[model samples]
Target chain A: MTTSTLTHLQTLEAEAIHIMREVVAEFRNPVMLYSVGKDSSVMLHLARKAFHPGPLPFSLLHVDTGFKFREMYEFRDWITKEVGAKLIVYRNEEAIKQGAHPLKLGVARCCGALKTKALLDALEAGGFDAAMGGARRDEERSRAKERIFSFRDEFGQWDPKSQRPELWDLYNCRMHEGESIRVFPISNWTEMDIWQYIRQENIPIVPLYYAKERMMVKRGAMLIPADDAGNLKPGEVPEPVMCRYRTLGCSPCTGAVYSSANSIEEIVAESAIATRSERETRIIDHGSNSMEDKKKEGYF
Target chain B: MNTLDKELFSAVETALLRFTTAGSVDDGKSTLIGRLLVDTKGVFEDQLDAAMGVEDKKGAKGAHLALLTDGLQAEREQGITIDVAYRYFATPKRKFIIADTPGHEQYTRNMVTGASTAHLAIILIDARKGVLTQSRRHAYISRLLGIPHIVVAINKMDLVDYSETVFKQIRQDFTDFYTNLGLIGGELTFIPMSALEGDMVVTRGTQLPWYQGQTLLEKLETAPVTGKINARDFRFPVQYVSRPQTEELHDFRGYMGRIESGSVKVGDHVTVLPSGLTSHIKEIVTFDGSLQRAFAPMSVTLTLTDERDISRGDMITHSNNLPRVEKELSAMLCWMHETPLTPGKKYLIKHASTTIKAMVTSLDERVDINSLEHIAAPIELKMNEIGRVSLKLLKPIACDAYANNRATGGFIVIDDFTNMTVGAGMIQ
Candidate 1:
């Protein structure tokens, strides 16, 4: 590579490392929120590089809604153990016991109570002052206005309309007692950038992202995986087909697209030609501007 | 793949600089972004394929460069960026994060949001329309936000027939306006280009034979990044106090936080803010190991030689120099809420390492964007307006001037009842 190109890359890396350091420096009792997704994996990897020769300064916080694909759990465990990070799994047993399924409570309410509320409760219980997330602005509308050092109230709610003006590289992470900050180091990353980074870094992702033969049923524009979460309507028959999930969310909500590409290379090639957004395939988001509604309730 | 990997690795090493593109609807902001990506080969094959599919359906012109940023279905159908779209690209020289903000006046909030964290602001001015109201407003906002660099991309040169006279006139106008606003600290470079025909974007164009300057990509790659932020006074807000409370390191006590500015060594004398408690640095600890000295933007746990009363929300700085701890502060605030900020309104004031209840003591003045005048009689600041206001904090909060220390001087006002961020203020 030319010296200038190398220098340019160094600049991006330096900024990311700087932001990671800021996260470590500003918040009291901070933790890295890991979703075991590709973006989260990239975040985890970046944190490792930010403090090379040392382990991650913070623990990993995962809010489990009890609706994750089984493969995601395996990837989560492997990553946690590989990084030697203390993992805190949070779940709202009350919601689970009350049988508040995605179909019953709707996607927004289910995510709010099970994921958002559970995360808030976890922060309160653990007394974590900040939580690092992998949310990128390119993902949704409300996320576009988020600050790098986003502040949350005592109730763990996000006020999208009123975000602190983050100027230059200076981020204000200070908050009152009981309030916490949400740090997103990869807020500038786009979907294509993430895929490119994944390819470049050779980051190991879950196999579910790759196309595979599975029994699925078509629901509207989405292909529903014939798993336990698939609440089949009367006379709905499942057929074996090659499909892959562009985005990994709750099984009940996340939709699959028909594809023959099964490897990372294939996935990358296929993703380039795909016209629809990653969220368009997700059935949950189709219900009601899913991300916007969830973000209002503090869902990261 | 190997070339791509090497490029990605190199891009990650540099500190990424975000910039915004501001121009009128027909000035070619979208086409500029499209050309940059295309010439640099940043657009993936699949992306090109997708664009081709869209092109086939619509039979549009100019390669649909706007499609590179307008990712949303609504935005694609409308042919306007309603919200800010962030696009990333890297060259051998530097990595870039482009906040492609819309030019519509209604989307002023989106522009502010995009320009807030940007280090540089690229103001696109069509040669035909020289220094319009929106261009001036954007340039003023860029200066107000303290963007250190400004690149005036004189786009649509093809339309202007690559006339140096037109480029010079427009350049002179912008320089005069920017200088009047006291934005001379940052360097300004003007380049004549056609985003549609790809002149001086990534490669040197033959059309602009008289223009002798580096391509946009070259300028971006070689531009000096603001470096060595540790020259100022050290400010580390105590995020938390880490005490393992375990058997192996039972007596371990470390003050954990990120260093906002300056440097901290093991033997330096530091003072804790608010309490004014002094202590000598004992050790600089990290998860991997201990460092002898830690500088700005590094997150590390500090163990003081003398254990004083240090807790979260407390600032640690050099013992010799300290920030002013005051209850009443004068600031320039950007009112972001629909409900205008009124005098005597109680709000949550969040400053460096601390949050306190504060009231608007007075509305000093509201800035008139078009004229750059501060109207004192303006009673209220509507949404997306800049104004000067005085705030009275319930308790003393430490602060530095926004010009000196952005980390300490900057603050946000939160609505007490709604828990929404109402406005952002820079201490005067």
Candidate 2:
């Protein structure tokens, strides 16, 4: 049979694998940031394919924000055991001790303390030189301009104006001792691409992505899960609704959309005609430059 | 609601085209991209509503389209893009990745970075400006970067009264300038467009009845890609070695890497460079399944029939066709650092999968951007300056000319102290 040219998905997969190998080859100690989301699921699948026969050389790092949905924790543990690689789960113990929740301290302070600050502290403690993320350019406006092998200073700050000129696949991974690099292997894959690849590879994802009848509380324009009824205010009621989350984040900061897309195929089709971006469901990204600011402060 | 149809899923498997846009700061490059995204239905309704609500800072009417591409906070505040922001949009026929580069003269390095991997480049020429120096400069850089296809779009025709005479004159001038650059053929095309009015970009908006040609989107959808790289000699730079070292697979050793160019198959005779050892492809392995053959850009593991002494940085090629193994060579180098590149400076030259210490022997000549003149024997190169330089590597590395196979031809120069990529080179 005559060989055929590769489809876009095939090409993207190849490029992503090539990038993963390059990171392992160049960096001293690398780690994969596993968020247990769909994008992370796809990244983990590619990582396994990138180095077959041989076990994974790098460990998976999960910065647990303590406020995530309970299902996410279960999936993370199950997948970590199946991958058979070392898993490092770091949480902000001080914040948890101080009872710092999104509702109490506000969204900005809560994310900054639990997610961003905790991530930096974990990387420093582990002495990791390279951290890999599953961030895609199509996710947000700021990410659309980031490099594949993004450089960060000793403080883990991202300078948007002074990025290195990345050319072709020749990623420049050299940096000072105090500085580090954040490599994104799936930087080119869009949301639809992630779902399609997940379906194609039969990769397992968290159950929260599909719609089901669940107890939800109405908050302004969003449907928040009624995980804890004690946090409700006056005139608030917990009710069952057919809803699904387009993204997975802190339970208080992530909202679910009303939909009946229970399967991967339906989600793919719904994404095709969806009027709002997936990030619209992210409550913390209200300001136009919120993501950019958080990134500068070392948020993944 | 649109359900998952067979045809819509097939669109996900279509060909992908990667291109870049180039023009002066005032040439509406961003506006053209916005128009493309809007017409292709790539923009979401929320994004449109937000754009329409942006506080018309510059008082440009109707949704400051330029704001769409300037994603950085500083760029928005300063009202000028400073880096290469990538954008994605697709039609049912093809998917596109647009590297939207800044047009300021100071940001030439960003433009070069954007154009390095592009299969095609759209050189925008403002119809009223009529092919200024910036237009010619952009065209020159696109040609230098070896972009296979070029579309010279005469933009803002609405401001020029949709004059056919202006469009023809600009096209003729651009052709003359490009012909003078020693590259000529069917690769160059021209399209008269008004991005603000949305003419001849995604659709033929009935403005230019005299001009019967493919719209910009049509040409982009149909442009050839990947064939340009796959047509060259087979080059595979080994990136890593995979060894299971387990009881079940104690003797398994696989060379892992992507096919930089050309194709490879089982039972094919190949040779490892720098060692001159011969081997036959025993098995082509992938997680999906084993294959009889694989082409360029596919990342696969190949276990050779013979256990040759091979490691990372060593190249594998067909036994008959080979690359030049040399220590001293000349290349067109683009300086990307603020510090001047003095002659006789030693730096790290990363080529293919190997990094070696290299020294610049001499600055042969610097190509003046404005006039395309070669200034002989320049002492040093400044930021964003393009020049020809001779380099001597400590170890001999296999290389192909940049024009032949871009995968193996390009290299980046790294500074020793800062460890940043300071220069980009294309072997001559």
Candidate 1's DockQ: 0.18
The reply for model 2, stretches above 4 Å from the true place, is A1-4, B1-4, B52-63, B184-186
- Native-vs-model 1 lDDT? 0.74
Candidate number 1, chain A TM-score: 0.93
Model 1 chain B: ten consecutive residues of lowest lDDT = B222-231
lDDT of 2 by residue, B1-428 (tens): 34346756877678778899998778988899988987887777666655556454446632467666678778778888888888888787787889999877777898899999798999998898888888878888887888889999999998988999999899889888888877633288999999988999998987888889899999998988764574558898999888889898799999999999888989989999877899999998898888998888899989999988899899999998899898998999999999989999999988889988999999999999878899999989999899999999998998898878788889999998888899999998
Summing lDDT over every window of 10 consecutive residues in candidate 2 chain B, give the lowest-scoring window: B54-63
Error of 2 at A48 (Å): 0.8
For residue B272, model 1's alpha carbon misses the true position, in angstroms, by 2.0
Clash counts for the predictions, in order: 28, 0
**lDDT of model 1 at position A291:** 60
Per-residue alpha-carbon lDDT of candidate 2 for residues A123-156, written as tens digits (9 for 90 to 100): 9999999999999998778898899999999999
